[model samples]
Target: MIQTVNGKIDAKDLGITMCHEHFIIDLSKVRGEDDSTLQDTKLMLKEVEKLKALGCQAVVEVTANDMGRDVIKLREISKAAGLHIIASTGFYLAPYHPKWLQESTIEDLKALFKKEITEGIEGTGIKAGIIGEVATSKNKILQTEEKVLRAAARASKELDCAVSTHCDMGTMGNEQVELMLSEGAHPDKLILGHIDLVSDILYHKGILEKGVNLAFDTIGKTKYLTDEKRADHLFALLDAGYEDHLLLSQDVSRKSYLCSYGGKGYTAVLGYFIDLLKERGISKPQLDKMLIHNPARILDRAC
Candidate 1:
């Protein structure tokens, strides 16, 4: 079964899921950016409603604890929007961690993650279904980020949940994957996010070689890379036989990234990017695997 904000459900119930997203978050504490704050539940629910209208059945909110994770609010949004919402546990990038995290040992961090997974997050009784958006820097994994990643690897191994990670501008994926593997994390239960930011097949292939799933989840952020370019890389990987090891999302967190704020809403992946993939020669079956099968398999923890 997969844990949702509302409760647990069979993996088959997690249909057409966007593997990475943010429904309610506040990154201002970390980035001091106004756009990063997704504070309005009403607005978030409206955006999610648009996604549901487009046939999105579930969304994995990758908002980790340090990234203003509000599981209580998420539960409300999930109920109101009628979308299965899978919440996350674990911290985000180094800057987002609390002061104690830097001094904490891997075992200390592991226990925290394990508690949230097995029990619930911060005494809310809303168990997290996944173990990340654990973030890393552009060139290297910082000391704190390393601790979190190793702890996440251990916790995910124990809890049997997927560990999704943020690859800053698409770097350090190889290192992150190697580190998770070194800690004996299941490769199939690992997701390396934002690789589409790099736009290099060889870079992606090297990380995929480690047998971890890749999230082409930064779709619709044309300022960084066009959706067409992201599709090109995705199709290339599919052609190379990595369809089962891939997932899709917009990674939409900032207010400006939402259509309500003049950006593509949560429905972009289902409403826009999927059509773009079809136009680019990606078959219906491949689209189904990325949007449905791949995420369901990774997020499900029925063992």
Candidate 2:
């Protein structure tokens, strides 16, 4: 079964999933930028409706506790938009981490994550369905970030939950995988995010060869990398027979990325990039594997 904000459902029921995304988040306080905040529910619902119309059934909402995670708002959006929203339980990068983290041990962090997944978050009864976007810094994993990663891995192992992660600017994926695996996380249950930003097929292939999943999640962020190049690299992986190990999403965490702000919003992958892939000779089965099959396989928890 796969846990969602509403409740657990059969994995097969999670159709056309986006592996990474954020809805109703506020990063203004941390980033000191107003555009990073996505607080308007009506505006968010408008964007989510567009995604639903484009055939998106669910989204893995990876906003961690330090990143203004509001499970209540997520539940509201999930119900209003009629989409399956999987809420996350974990910390983000060091800068965004809460004050208590420095004093916390690995066991302390692990217990908190477990409680959120199995019981509920902050006594609200809205349990987290996944253990991530637990993150590492760019080119280096900080000491506190390492503790969070190890704790997230151990919690995921204990509860049979999947872990989604943030690889800053697509760096340190291999190191993150090594640390998590060392803490007993199953490779298949681990997803390394933002790898599409790296632009190196060999780097991507190396991570996949380790038997873990890759999220080409920053789909519409043309400022970082063009969608055309993303397609080219994605096709390379699919051609190499790693189709089942890939997942796709937009990682739309900012208000500027929303259609309401003249951005592509959550539908960029389904509305735009999928066509780019199809034109690049990616077949229907390969698309299905990334969109439906791989997500279901990764998100489903063992009963």
Candidate 3:
């Protein structure tokens, strides 16, 4: 299991957590730039150390099958960086991927994912740290796409890792969650990531009603709606009485892992969010529940 940045790990120990963020993700999109994609541990450690010092106890590094998710490297880097690392399993953006058609069934992909977790990923006896931060394109949900998600849901049910996904522009979260629920996945084990990009309050509420975790964190990118708005959304969700179901994070990564992102990455998401919340008048206990108790529970973790 990957350790937390501050060395306190366990479901309950993932305090002030960010549910789904990438530590270092280099997709095939960065193909033929192998040297550029490979991360330098010493440099990455600087960021990790900063996060640890800043109070980022844990982060779920969700680099999927196609999106440059590296369990071994993440484990090694996290250990050196002194952070507890949680890794994601599964594939990326089904519509954008050609392999979407290759799998005859999501069950097949589930088998592969299960094998990875149960047996080992890439020959490392270490299983995936989490089920997935799976993805699909905007309004382009295909038949197989639903199937793969359902399979992932089943796998998450079987394996006990948190299952999450990226949402499309509008109404996708609602559709996606319905699909997963139809397939027998527990709503409690699900995380609806990327709600910021998805623009619909009704859609967000609809998904939240399904008992799935609604993560409305897209901070650190000033170009985003604004911390005030992000705060508004978080509090609105909380005020709407869903605070227990929310999670937060920036999704930032070290520049080398991602060719883009000027690397204005977080040494500590917990530190940043706390400051933002306080400036916005959020109480200490309220903030604590959102970042600490809530995330631990949502991870379906008793630890």
TM-score of each: 0.98, 0.98, 0.85
Clashes (N, CA, C under 3 Å) per candidate: 0, 0, 8
Q: Which digits, one per residue and each the tens of the lDDT, describe model 1 over residues 54-161?
A: 999999999999988899999999888888999998888888899999789999999998888878998999898999889999898899999999999998888888
Q: Report lDDT (CA) for all predictions.
A: 0.90, 0.92, 0.66
Residue 61 lDDT in candidate 2: 95
Over 1-303, each residue of candidate 2 has an lDDT whose tens digit, in order, gives 988999898999999999999997778887899888887788889999999999999999999988888999999999999999999999999988888899999999999999999899999998899998999999999999999999999998898889999999999999999999999999999999999999999999999999999999999999999999999898889889899899999999888888988889998899989988888788899999999999999889864
- What's the C-alpha lDDT at position 209 in model 1? 82
**Number of residue pairs clashing in candidate 3, backbone atoms closer than 3 angstroms, sequence gap of 3 or more or interchain:** 8
Ranking by TM-score: 2, 1, 3
> In model 2, which runs have C-alpha deviations exceeding 4 angstroms?
none
TM-score: model 3 vs. ground truth: 0.85
Give one digit per residue, the lDDT tens place, for model 3 in 147-247. 66887888877776578787653337877788888877888888877786554556667788889888765665556466656676676676788767877
Report the backbone clash tally of model 2. Answer: 0
